[model samples]
Target: MHVGVDVGGTKVLAVELTGAGADVAVARSAQVPMPGRTAADAEVEAAVARAVADVADGRPLAGVGVSAAGLVDREGRRVRFAAHLPWRDAPVRDRLAERIGVPVVLDNDANCAARAELDAGALRGVDFALLITVGTGIGGAVVVDGHVVRGANGMAGEFGHVQVVPDGLPCECGLRGCWEQYCSGRALERVTRVALGSHLDGPEVAALARAGDPVALEAFATVGTWLGVGAAGLVSALDPERVVIGGGVSAVGDLLLEPARRALGGALQGTSHRDLPTLVPTRFGPEAGAVGAALLAAAGD
Candidate 1:
């Protein structure tokens, strides 16, 4: 058996795999509360270890794969930096390997999601594909042939940071005009709050927009436009054959994709000629990360 762990800001999901790639077994999840004032790195690591132990039981795990939210290094064993977590240049793989008594592999959460999609979700059977996730932030991954493009510094496909507007909305990455600032779940909330003077979760906001809420509808349109613009930029840069979108906001479906499709057509270079890549919603949805992690672990074995 192989263990896969998708470690998110709010929770940790663990899955067992019986075969390679998409052939995943039943999954078990555990909530990981964000550490408070007194939390330390060891504490966080301990939480992860405990979660892995509970899920693994006594099955002999060939390896453990972690899909983490951060800039994982090229080595696939260390976390270079994580915006939400306390880890910076942490040897996550080694720590987990030592505690679990098995090999551990680490990957960026978005990359893992993309891999999962490619293996068994929307991008399956495609030689080249891109996975763009729109959630609290925008994340992208490119797969060429059958392998993921990790870039030279393991920071490629950061489509969120691409500058869309000059000196526009401020981003958490200490930049202005980032694509994420205008296209993410948080962006939707900000727009709705500013226009409606209220906050709504992603699905509720989309429902309101569908129900003739002008402010909510307009907010989605704006975000969709930015999403398409960013996707177009990614297409220009990577030229993938297909693009798959996933995340909470994507649950809004056509409310968001129609505008994105229009914007992509308008913004793409050579819009008048040449074939355009297909843009579709992810098949695996929220479980892509966990499934991908399981696939990675299985492959390592």
Candidate 2:
């Protein structure tokens, strides 16, 4: 079985994939909380190894794929940087391979998600598209001519760090007013806290929003609005045929997307002349990253 791991901001998720081609499916999965950002790179890699082992459950050998939430080098050998994690020019792929005792492939988590969508989920036959994942922070991938673009520095889709606000909010990447500061899980939590005058995590805020809490509902609106505004800029630049939204925050569905759609329609450039790109939630949701990673490993990508 091929094991794929998604190393996110708060957890390490592992999925065991079985079968081939269109028959591929996740047979089992496991997760472990991510070590704190202050932890050493070895500790974080160990957490990923543990999750992979838990999901494999002592099964026979197969290659492993890692969907890392960072700037994975174009060669997929090193994690150049990760704002929320401790990896900094770390040789993560080699280290994880050594620990797991298997051939390993690594890539940016958002790129992995885009690969999954292109392979089997949403972007199957599409020629160009943009994928934005709204988890702890934003992650993104660009598709052009049916291929994901890696850019000159292998960091083309690091859109989360885009300065949307002028010195607005501080980011872990040491930037101010990044798009993620206004449109991610962390942003949702911050907005909800400000509205309700207390702290609450992403899931808690979603729960309250589902139950029609005014503060929670408003928080989604706020974040969703920012999401659209930022996406408008990207659409203007890339002009992708479709814009897919994924990640943990997208699980709330229309509670978040509806607001985003409205804002995109209003804020987008050339509204009267250009055809607006469709903004939809991810078909595979939060699992897209891991699924894509497995596909990469299976195909030796």
Candidate 3:
């Protein structure tokens, strides 16, 4: 069996997979709390290792793949930094390998999810695809020529940090008016709270949208506009065959997508010409990261 681990800001998720190619089976899965942002590197690695152990179930492992929410080096062995989690230049692969006694591969969480989509989910036969992960912030990945574009610094797909407003909301990356600040889960929460004067979280807002709450619907429309605005830039630059929106906020679906579609049409450079890419939802859901990580590890072998 091959193991995949997704280490997030608040939790660690691990999955065990058996089989090959598109026929892979999910054997088991586990989740654990991640270390605090102030946590030491050892603490973070230990939490990830514990999650892997919980899911392995004593099966002979091929290798462990880790999907991390942060910048990773070109080699995909080190996590350069993670804003929400405490990791900086951390040798995650080597340390985790030492603990598990197997090979470990690490990559940006969005890259893993994108790989999952390309190999077994949304972008299956597409030659060029863009995946935008909408969560606390946006993370992105591109599949070009059947391979994830890692870029020169392995930071090519940071779609969130792309500036949208010159002097807009402050971002976690110390920038002002980043695309994620206005388009992600955090943006949803902020807009809901400020506009409705209610303290509803993301899921609560989603529920409200389902219930047809006018305020919630409007908030989604606003955020969706920003999402589309940024997406237009990506579409212009990459021109992927499709764009898949994943991560937690994707649950809101067309509440955001309809607006995104409208805005994307307006924002595109040449609105009247060119075939726009298909913008769709992800089929893999939250487990995409872990599943894709394991797939990547298995492929390397």
Candidate 4:
């Protein structure tokens, strides 16, 4: 058996795998709340260890894979930085491996999500695509020639940090007007708060939208529009055949995607002359990261 851990901004999700390759299946899963933004590195690590042990349930493990939301080094041994997590130039993989008494591999959370899609989800059998995960923040990955493109420094797809708005909202990364500030789960909460004068997380806001709350509907429209606008720029540059949307925020489906499709149509240049990439949702939903990480561990990569 193997275990995969997805350490996100708000929680630590872990899954145990029962097979290898296309036969791989999630045997068990667990989650734990992550430490607050100001948490120490040891606190965050302990949370991850707890999740892994919970999912493992004392069963022996072959290896472990970690899908981290940050700029993981190419060697998968260190996390160069994480805007939402406590790690900064930290040797996370080795530390976790030591604690779990098993080999551990690490990669960017978005990269792991994309790997899952490419293996058996939306991007399967496709050559050239883009994946954008709208969670607590935005995470992106570029797939070209049937593989993810990890650019120099293995941080090619940090799309959230892209400056979409000039001197816009302040970001946790010590930047202003980042794309994530406008088009992520956090973005949804921020917009909803403005409309209803109430604070709600992504899932709560999504629940309100599903219940036909006008404030929630308006929030989705606003964030969805921004999502499309950012995608338009990426489409123009990469021209992938498809763009896959994953992560917690994508659970709303068309409520978010339809508006993004509309905005992409309007914002993309030469739309009438060029074939615009089709936008679709992930097959694995929010668990893609955990599932993909498990696959990586199964493959011993």
Task: Estimate the TM-score of every prediction.
Answer: 0.92, 0.93, 0.96, 0.92
lDDT (0 to 1) per candidate: 0.81, 0.89, 0.88, 0.89
Candidates sorted by TM-score, descending order? Answer: 3, 2, 4, 1
lDDT of 2 by residue, 74-146 (tens): 8999999887789999999999999989999999999999998888777888888999999888889999999
The C-alpha RMSD in Å for every predicted model, in order, reads 2.2, 1.8, 1.4, 2.0
Q: By summed lDDT, which 10 consecutive residues of candidate 4 come out lowest?
A: 17-26
The TM-score of predicted model 2 comes to 0.93
- Candidate order by lDDT, highest to lowest? 4, 2, 3, 1
Clashing pairs in 3: none
The best candidate in terms of TM-score: 3
Better of 2 and 4 by TM-score: 2
Candidate 1 C-alpha lDDT tens digits along 72-174: 9888878898777778898999998898888888899889988788777788788888888999898878899978899998877778888889999888899
Better of 1 and 4 by lDDT: 4
Encode model 3's per-residue lDDT on 1-301: one tens digit a residue: 6789988888999998766656665778999898789988889888888888888767677789999999999998789999988888988889899988989988999999988888778888888989999988899998888788999999989999999899988987898989999998889999999997878889999999989999999989999998888999999898888999999998878998899989988998776778888889987778889988988888873
Residue 94 displacement (Å), model 1 = 0.3
